[model samples]
Target: MDAADAMAYLFSPQGRVDPYPAYERLRAHGPVVEIAPGLYVATGYAAIDEVLRDPRYEVTHEELTQHPVAGWAESPAVASLTGSMLRANPPDHGRMRQLVAGAFTPRRVAAMRDVVTAQATALVAEMARRGRDGATLDVMDEFAYPLPIGVICALLGVPEADREAFRGWTVDFAAVLEPEISDAELAVADRGAVALRDYFRDLVEARRRAPADDLTTALVQAHDAEAGRLTGDELLANLVILLAAGFETTTNLLGNGLVVLLRHPRHAAALRDDPALAGEYVEELLRIDSPVQVTSRKATVPVTPGGVPVPAGGRVLLLLGAGNRDPERFAEPSRFDPTRPHNQPLSFGGGPHYCLGAALARLEAQVAFPLLLRELPGLALAGEPRHRTRLTLRGYATLPVTVDADQHHRVVVPVPAGERGTPTGAGSGTP
Candidate 1:
């Protein structure tokens, strides 16, 4: 396909299933290809990287957001999103991020190692048990969705019993982010946004009355102005986005990572044999198949990215997936080789607007993947994998899989983070 055709194809259902080939087609044209007047799509690593880190290339803040998502003010989903740091620029973004950054510090994420281990183990073991008889299990439903949701819930101080409700809310909140949305979908997303907003409001009040050792309580303190600088609206919007975004990225990462590993059993075997290698493997997996595929930025002044001049007020859609596989940056771009030196993927984005929970998401993948490979010894795909029809938040909706009946995994013992290099005794049914 030509560059324009390739760009249009990205919004097609077929393109959404697998867009790498199309991305390559776009790359063949140039690093950045303008599909419309004052608008461009950056398919090369260098170009997208430059724009992402450049202050001149700004995110669409609330005032600018209306230009694209018209009627955003009336939509609850769009309002919640535009209010959060996700849409904030500079000073406001910095202030809000600082207030919540404490929750995801290195020490904090490291402390959650035990929590992730236990949650992933329990979920994987449960899948093993259900599939012990060669019964097909949708691993996406059984493992991928639950593990990340559980972890995010744990982080937000959400009680385990109340975690089930977030799934639907997440689906609703996420719908508004896709490449296309119908009126019905928009309505659903609005309801979902309102529900999430109200839920967090109640949650904040509860935290105020009976403070807990979770991020919610900390945010409450910040919102009340006694400890930090958050407004009540800021607290509500952030809480809604945090819980929704916190799980969304990791959920897609795990789902996409599994499909990659299952297709390349050799690499999966290697990871299982040496869990210590999971860190590098996860990076490669992320590079090969990014979860958040597209992000756009508007120009504040006339500037060039990848030698292509963008006039003032111009916009560029950063094709992150394409950038990750740019041949100029990565040798044999499409190949999934963890041994590549200096693997720097844009999966989590870059610069000021980079994902705040990036480290936490990486940790979740690193811990969960090895545990899965080791525990499910003979795990394999049982049927065609189903892809979620989303160009932005791309991943599998269902992955039919089964394990060797005789080798089904037993309950997992929580493995401490420091001891990851050592084997956790997978087949022996002991941690």
Candidate 2:
């Protein structure tokens, strides 16, 4: 198929489960190819990296709002949430990022390792208990999805009772991140945005009156200190941004990571043997199947990426997952090698807008994966997995697995063998 036709196929639902072949076709056409008017797609490592790091390429919400795309930029709710740092460029992005950076410091995230591990352990234990009678387990529901959401909710001071309500918001907000959308989907996204804003508005007020030792409280303090810096609306929007960005993205990572490991039994076996390799495994997973597949930037000046000229005001979509598998940068790029050195994938992105919660996400994975492998020895896909409909934040809608009795026996207590027990530099954010 031609590049355009291939890209169309890449976005088709039939291709959602496996887009690698389509990506290869697009990459072969050129590192940078114009997908449509004012839109360019970059696939190769060099081009994707350059675009990500280029200052002239901006991520302004206004750009998205002005785009002809339906639902995403057009929806009022989507526009409000995207106005956060994720879509801001330069100074504004820098300001919002700095405000939240202290909580996501390497020291802070490192300190969270224990809490993350404990959560994963409990979830896996529950799964084992529930599946004891040969009952199939939905990994996404039982483990992968809830782990990150629960952690993020705890960090944000969201009550467990209210989690179910917020989970719907998470799904709604995530729909806006896609390249394509429908009117019905936009309405759902709008409802999600409104529900989330109302929920956080009350929560923020409660935190203001009775401040807690949580990120929400910190954000409140930050807003008060820098009065004109962040409006009340901005504060709510930022919180929604954090919830949507933090929860859904990490869910994909965990789900995709497990899928990759299951497909590569040797790597899964190695992880089961040496838990310390969890860090390496997380990096490999990020490269092999990045959760955040595509990020867009608007060019401020005419520039050339991989010999393709992009005019000022042009939109550039960086295919991060495709770049992670570029053979020119990674030897045998398609292979899943946990031990691969210098495996710097564009999964967490780069440059000024690099993901602020990356450290926390990595910490979550480092703690979650090893504990999962140790807890569920015979864990295997229960059935054919189903991918989510969204193309941008590529992930599975459901991942069902079956765990055996041996896996059930592994989670009898809080302390697993060889586990340090103590939270390592708990919440220190050292990395």
Candidate 3:
């Protein structure tokens, strides 16, 4: 297939489940190819990496606002969302990122290890309990989805009771990110944004009245009275972005990681034998199947990537997932080797816009995977998995798994006064 044909197939719903073949075709074309009149696509590792790190490339909301697309970047709702750091350039992006960087320090993420472990363990236990009567478990519902949502909710001081509504809002908001979205989808996104604004408005008011020790409160306090670092709309847009990006991306990571492991039984067995192998497994999973597949940047000046020239004011789509599996950069890129060396994946894009939640996502996966192996040794897919109807943020809508309860004993660990406990006793079980 040519570049344009490949782009069409890659963004189509049918390709959501597996876009590798299309990605391979795109990469084979060249380092960069114009998919359309003003759009360029980069699939090679070097090309994608260069664009991600290049100072000439910018991610501005103005590009979206100016686009003629019906569903994406065309109204007041889109304008309100431009306040977020993801849509801002240099100084604004730098300042917003720095303000939140302190909260995601290595020490802070390390300290959250116990919390992640406990949350994953609890979810597994609950899944086991619910499945005790021979019921099949939906991995997405039982484990992958809830864990990150709970974690982000706790971090943001959002109540657990509000999680369901928040999840709906997240779904609608994320739908707007896909390429070639429909007007119906945009209307849903608009409604979601309005609802979220109202929700955060009340949340901020409450925090103002009774300051709490959470990220939301910190963000509120960070806004100096005279300087006005963030306005009410900006805070709401950011909170919405955080809630959606934080939960949805990590949820997909865990789901995709597990799918990869199951397909490569050897890797899964290795992880079972050595729980410490989780760090490597997580990294390899990120390389093989990243949650965020595509990221876009607008060229401020004419630039050449992979020897292909991109004109100024043009849009460049970086296929991060494709770059992660480029044969030039990785030996046997298609193979899912847990122990791959020099595995610097572009899963988390490079430069200033790199994912702020990378550390937390890694911690969640590191804790979740081992606990899953321990809880259900014979955990296997019950049926074919279904992918979410999203091209940008790829993930499973449902993953049915059957747990062989007879092969493993259920272990209950206590939640300490201030912390949570880890699972104990590692042994072999029938696969």
Question: Top model by lDDT, which number?
Answer: 1
RMSD of candidate 2 to the truth, in angstroms, is: 7.4
Residue 334, model 1: Cα distance from true site in angstroms? 1.4
Q: Judge candidate 2 at residue 188 and give its lDDT.
A: 84
Model 1, C-alpha of 45: deviation from truth (Å): 0.5
lDDT per residue, candidate 3, 1-431, as tens digits? 78878877876777766788889889888878887777888889999999999999999454332235565545534754577887789888887777677777889989999888888888998987877665678899888889999999888899889887877777777766665566777788788777777888798888999999888888888774536677666677777777878898999999988876665545577787788988978998899888988888999999998888888988888888889988899876776666678788998889888989999999999888878877877777666777887777888999877676563342222221211122112321112
Model 1: residues >4 Å from true position, as ranges? Answer: 61-70, 226-228, 405-431
Error at 363, model 3, angstroms? 0.4
Range of the 10 consecutive residues with the lowest summed lDDT in candidate 1: 422-431
Instruction: Write one digit per residue (lDDT tens) for candidate 1, span 340-407.
Output: 67998999889998888989899999999998889998787776788887777888888877777353
TM-scores for every predicted model:
0.90, 0.90, 0.91
Q: How far is candidate 3 from the true structure (C-alpha RMSD, Å)?
A: 7.1
| 56-158: candidate 2 lDDT, tens digit per residue | 8888454332235555546757666566778776677788888788888888888888888788888989987888776778888898788998999988999
Please give the CA lDDT of all the candidate structures. 0.81, 0.79, 0.78
Candidate 3, 176: how far from true, in Å?
1.7
Ten contiguous residues with the weakest lDDT in model 3 = 415-424
Worst 10 residues of 2 by lDDT: 422-431
